[model samples]
Target: MARYRFRFVACDEGFLRTFAGSAWRGAFGGALKRVVCAMRLRPCEGCPLAGTCIYPHLFEGRQGADPVRLKSLDRIAVPYVFELDDVVPRSFGAGSEVTVTLTLIGDANRRLARSYP
Candidate 1:
């Protein structure tokens, strides 16, 4: 397993302060999914390649059969874990910074992190 750390600074103080945890997480997930999904399909069900797509497997997760029927086991195990530092301030100014940690395991660790376009 490997962990990557990222630091981000809010450009606008007013905007940063308004974002709560769930709101910020949704935005973050949307941005990450957009970069990873090459097909850019709004709905996963409409995508022809969804069965073999890496983005859905990692983000949306595998569906269908759950033979074991474990509790809350609707999807396959996720390959990465996200950890946001708990001490982050509720608000930020133009220069305020926050750190995010991602722990990658299994196949996810083998993929290289790179800038798209």
Candidate 2:
């Protein structure tokens, strides 16, 4: 198990204020896919590389994967977990920072470490 910490500063306080937990999660995952996805597909359905793409592997798990290794399972476990502090304020001011801790397990650590800085 390995963990990586990241800090993100909001450029627009107004924008940050609009996000609730669920909305923030959706936006965060969308942005992460955009950052990592090579094909830039709007929906990853039927993507040729879904089995190997880091975006899908981390976010969606392996869909329709062969169950030879893990019997009767459609997808494997999501290899990373997100930890967000509960101390967030109602709204952030400009240049406010948030810390997100990502814990990677199994092959996720090695795969991400080599590709991410």
Candidate 3:
């Protein structure tokens, strides 16, 4: 497993609810797809690139093209998680900083490292 920390300084005043995990996850997923989807395929069900695409691997937990194998598994847990501090204030003023920690398990870190670097 590997961990990474990202810091963001608010440019303007904003309010984030306490326990913003869902909000963060939604934003991250959308942004990731936008940045990585090359074929512009909606749903990604039959896209030829799904097996090797980072978007599906990270967001949808899809591994490969084996239909039977994919159907046999009930659920494939996402390979990454978010670690947020409970004590951080939810509301932000201009210049307020927020730190988000992400942990990637197993081959996830290695896969992403190749994509990014």
**Highest TM-score: which candidate?**
3
Query: Local error of candidate 2 at 90, Å?
Result: 3.0
TM-score list, all predictions: 0.65, 0.71, 0.82
For model 1, the stretches where C-alpha displacement exceeds 4 angstroms are 14-24, 63-74, 86-89, 111-117
Candidate 3 least-lDDT 10 residues? 66-75
Pairs in clash, predicted candidate 1? none
Cα shift from native, residue 79, model 3 (Å): 0.6
Per-prediction CA RMSD (Å) = 5.1, 3.5, 2.9
lDDT per model vs. reference:
0.60, 0.67, 0.75
Rate residue 106 of model 3 by lDDT. Answer: 75
Superposed on all Cα atoms, model 1 deviates from the true structure by an RMSD in Å of: 5.1
Off by over 4 Å in 2: 14-24, 63-71, 114-117
lDDT score, candidate 2, position 22: 49
lDDT tens readout by residue for model 2, 19-54: 244455576678878887788656777777666566
Encode model 3's per-residue lDDT on 1-117: one tens digit a residue: 999888888899987776676777788889888877888747778788887777777778876445344577633778899877545446788998877788888767767876777
Tell me how far the alpha carbon of residue 8 in candidate 1 is from the true structure, in angstroms, after superposition.
Answer: 0.3
Candidate 2's TM-score: 0.71
Candidate 3 local lDDT, residue 83: 75
